[model samples]
Target: MNRYERTRVLVGGDPGVAQAIAAEIEEICEVEVLDAPREELVMVKVRESARNSLFYLGEALMCSCRVRIADAMGFGYVLGSKRNAAYNLALIDAAFSSGEEFERMPKWEERIEKEAKRQRDKRAKNRALIERTRVDFSTMDGDA
Candidate 1:
C-alpha cells in the first residue's frame, strides 16, 4: 500500500467563499485551503480516504458559483508516479497560500548557490591535478 496520500478540491470564488467551503471540509477532515483570486480558484487538500467526500463538497461549492476541479491525484509514492501531480499541487498551494508580502527564503537560495560553487571548484581542482599528472611519453628515454 502507498504511504503518502493527498486529496485536492478545487472551488471557484474569492477567499471568503473558499474559506467557507474549506471550513466545512475541515470539520470532517484535515485540510489546507489556498485561494488564488487571480485564477478565480480555491484549492483544498485532504487525506486520501477523504477524497470522495471532498469531491462531493467541491460540487456543492461549484453549484453556488462558477468553479472547476483542476486536478486530482490520489495515494502513491509522492516522489515517484505522483511527482508531477505533487509538484503542481504544491506550486498552486504555495502561490495561493503565501501572504501578499511573503518573500522567498534568501538563506535557502544562498545555501544552494554556495553548494553549487563548491562542486564547481572541486571539479576544476580535479581536472587541474589530472592535467598536471599527464606524462609526455616522447620526452622520456627508453632506458635510463
Candidate 2:
C-alpha cells in the first residue's frame, strides 16, 4: 500500500500561525491551509490509515493551535471566537474512539435502501400519471 496520501488542512485566524503549523505538518504529512477566519474553528483533512496515531497527532495539532492563539492574542480575545475549533476537536476524538458506534456502513446501506424505494415509488407514480393522461384522440377524430 502507498505510505503517503494527499491531504489538506485549513487553519483559521492569524496567517502567520496557520502558516507555521501548516509548514510543520507538511514536513511529515501533506497539508494545505486556508487562513480565513470567516467561520468558526479550523478544519484539517488527512488520510493516514485513520488510525489512532494519526488521530492523536491531529488532536495534538489542534491543541497546539489553541495554545498558540491564546498566547499571541490573549485568552479572552480568542476564547469565544467564530472558529469551530471545539467542534473539530470533538469530531476528531469521536472519530478516533467511537469504534463500532461510529461505523457508517449501516447508515450508508440504510440511506441507499431508502433512496431506492423512493425512486421505485416515484417511477410507479409517474407511470400511473402517464397512463391516466394518455389520449384517445384517434377514436375521437373517427367519431367526429
Give lDDT tens digits, candidate 1, residues 58-127: 3111111111223321211122232333333433333333332223333323433454465568879999
Quantify all predictions' global Cα lDDT against the true fold: 0.34, 0.33
RMSD (CA, Å), candidate 1 to true, equals 19.0
Taking all chains together, each candidate's TM-score versus the true structure is 0.28, 0.26
**What are the per-model C-alpha RMSD values against the true structure?**
19.0, 19.1
Candidate 2, residue 53: lDDT: 44
Q: Top TM-score: which candidate number?
A: 1
Model 1 scores a TM of 0.28
TM-score of predicted structure 2 = 0.26
